[model samples]
Target: MLKAVSLGPGDLSLLTPAARWAVEEAEVVAGYKGYIELIPDEVLEGKIVVSTGMMGEVDRARQAVEHARAGRKTVMVCSGDAGIYAMAGLLMEVLESEGLLKTVPFEVVPGVAAFNAAAALLGAPLMHDFASISLSDLLTPWERIEQRLQAAASADFVIALYNPRSRKRSDHLREALGIIGRYRRPSTPVGMVRKAYRAGQFVEAVPLKAVDVDKVDMQTVLIVGNSATRLVEGRMLTPRGYHRKYAL
Candidate 1:
């Protein structure tokens, strides 16, 4: 059996029990080098660990599938929820294309996604409706991403941005801000959380127009509040209609 386990966002404490158990029970573990390093040394001791660098996801998924086919319990490790722009979907596609989807039994173990983790640190900015969108155009086209951003912004949905910016994609976040700025107020609340719950964690809430794009990178998750969102005593919050449905 193969298990796709989410390791959470850089914090060992954020790892779910089922994810930890999947790793503990696996004979082989495969994932990107950075994510693998997040696991405790003791857990990987004496285990067949395969570490791959960036853009080697296909190779890593193939290795995990092969190991599972050979009767070795294997786990494909990913940061955050594996299904959310991670290895789970890729692994499934590979297995299906290779005619092994039904032959090999697999399960996905969920963990704290970056947006949820960042939202917790920033308070309840997601108390109302929200949408998550990735700014990376490596696989997805920038045009499609823009449409989604425009729709989410125009609808006043709280937006969680993943892969907001990177070294090679420095201008993407600024472009996204421009698109969102068309629909949202310049004073809209925006929360930025970098390396949430991990070492060197940084969290800040600023106005949408005042956001420092340079401070945002791929490791950060930015939550742009909806029209109903507010900053309450330094914390970001969005009402859940509790005030209207009942007296509070």
Candidate 2:
């Protein structure tokens, strides 16, 4: 059996029990090196670890599938929910390509995603409709991402941005903010959480115009408010319109 487990943003406490059980019961564990490092030492003490650096996702997935086919209980771990910008789909693709999709037993153990963790830290900014977009253009085209941002902004949906910035794509986030700026006011609320629930965690709420782009990186999750969103006290909030029908 193969299990794709989510570690939930490098914080063990946020990792779901099912995900931890998948990892603990596996004889072989395969994942990106960074995410593998986040697993508790005790849980990984007796497991055969397969780890690789950046751009090695396909190799890792292939190895996990092969290990599972060999009758070893194998698990692939990824930070946040595995289905969200993680290894679940890639593993499925590899399994199908290997012709073991039907024969192999597989399961996905979901956990708290970055946006979920970020939203909790930033208060209820996603109380209404929202869109999640990744600024990374490695696999996705920039044109399509820009179109999504434009649509999400124009539709007045709260926006959650993932992979907001990286060394090579330094300008993407700023450019996205620019596109959104055309639809949102300069004073619109924007909240950023870096390394949420993990070491060096940082959370800030500021106006869209005052965002410090240089401070953002791949570890940061940015939540841009909708037209009706606001900063209440220190929290970023978006109303659900229940007030329209209720008396207080």
Candidate 3:
């Protein structure tokens, strides 16, 4: 089976059984270099390995398909969830564009996305109305991102910011925070989750005013909850389930 599985942040524990199976059983494995260490070394012994740095998607997808075509069951891995800006989309795009879908069997194994992991770590920051947007200008434009952030904030929707920053674009996160800060309260709860589920996992909740955008990178996901969001016993859950369930 040609499977695209999510590794769920960087933590091996969060790698679901389905994802593990695809990784272990495959004769060929394709993934980014960051994922090279994440693969179980025992399972990878003697397997055909293909890895690349970030942003080499088209070539990587082609390599995976080449290995799959050579009669090897291939598994392509991505961090966080498979469907959220991961290899699954690129794989499908290549297959569909080349009309290779019928030639190969493919499946997507879901994993815990960064935003969800961050929310859980921060206490239910997404329990109520919320919206998510990726800040990386690599795939989406900054203007479009600004529009979405403004709209989400204006609609009073809690916002989850993904791919907040990277080495090439270090200032994007600060710009995003500035945009949201205009609409959100300075005291609003903001969560930053990094290395989620991985060995060096960290999750912190700070007021909007206290956030240090410079420290944020692609490894981090930032969740900015609406004004109504509260920390109950240090949990970051919004009030949808709690408020609606008990409402008269």
Candidate 4:
């Protein structure tokens, strides 16, 4: 059986029971280097490991399947949630067409994604209806992301920004914030979460108007609240708990 597991952002503690089992029992663990490193060396000591350095995502998926077809238990790991802009969706799509579904059993184990971890760092900024949008132009074009940003802002939905920066696409995030700023309030709460799980983590709170575009990189997730969103005390909590309408 082939299992696609999520390591849960960058934090080892967020790994679910199913994901841990899949990793520990697998004979071959295939994933990006960062995720592979997340698992301790002792756990994957004897397993055959494959590392993909950003390019050829589809090729790596094929390689994982070949291992599975050979009756090797393969765990294709991904960062954050497996399905949220991860390898689970693409792998499943191609596998179904190739009839690998009938030959090998597979599972997608859920994990604590970036938005949840980032929101926690900023408080409850996503307590209400929210939308997650990626600024990456690798597959989805920048034009499509721009359209989503405008729609999300106009609808008063809290927005979670993923893949905020890369070498060639550093300015896309700032442009997105600019577009969102036009529709939302200037003081809307914006929370930046860096390395949510791993070491050297940092979280910052900023108003929409005061955000510094230079602080973000590919490892960051930015959460921007709707018009109704506000920073309370030091946290960026969304009011999804209980309303105080009846209170004095």
Best by TM-score: 2
Top of the candidates by lDDT: 2
lDDT minimum window of 10 residues, candidate 3: 239-248
**Over 4 Å off, model 4:** 241-245
- Residue runs of model 2 more than 4 Å from their true location after superposition: none
Ranking of all predicted structures according to TM-score, beginning with the best and ending with the worst: 2, 1, 4, 3
State the lDDT at 138 in candidate 3.
Answer: 77
Judged by lDDT relative to the true structure, which candidate is superior, 2 or 4? 2
| C-alpha lDDT score of every prediction, in listed order | 0.91, 0.92, 0.84, 0.86
lDDT by residue (tens digit), candidate 2, 2-101: 9989898887789888998889889999999989999878989989999999789999999999999999999999988998988999999999998998
User: Please, what are the lDDT tens digits per residue for candidate 3 over residues 76-186?
Assistant: 988888888788988988878878799889899999988888887888888678899988887677899999989998888999998888668788888888888888889
lDDT of 1 by residue, 1-248 (tens): 88899999878788888999999999999999999999999999999998999889999999999998888999999988897889999889878888888989989998898888999999999988899999999889999999999999998899999998866779999999899999989988999999888889999999999999999878889999998888888789898864597766
Position 62, candidate 1: lDDT: 94
For model 2, state the Cα shift of residue 203 in Å. Answer: 0.2
* TM-score of every candidate: 0.97, 0.97, 0.92, 0.94
- lDDT (Cα) of model 1: 0.91
Task: List residue ranges in candidate 1 displaced over 4 A.
Answer: none
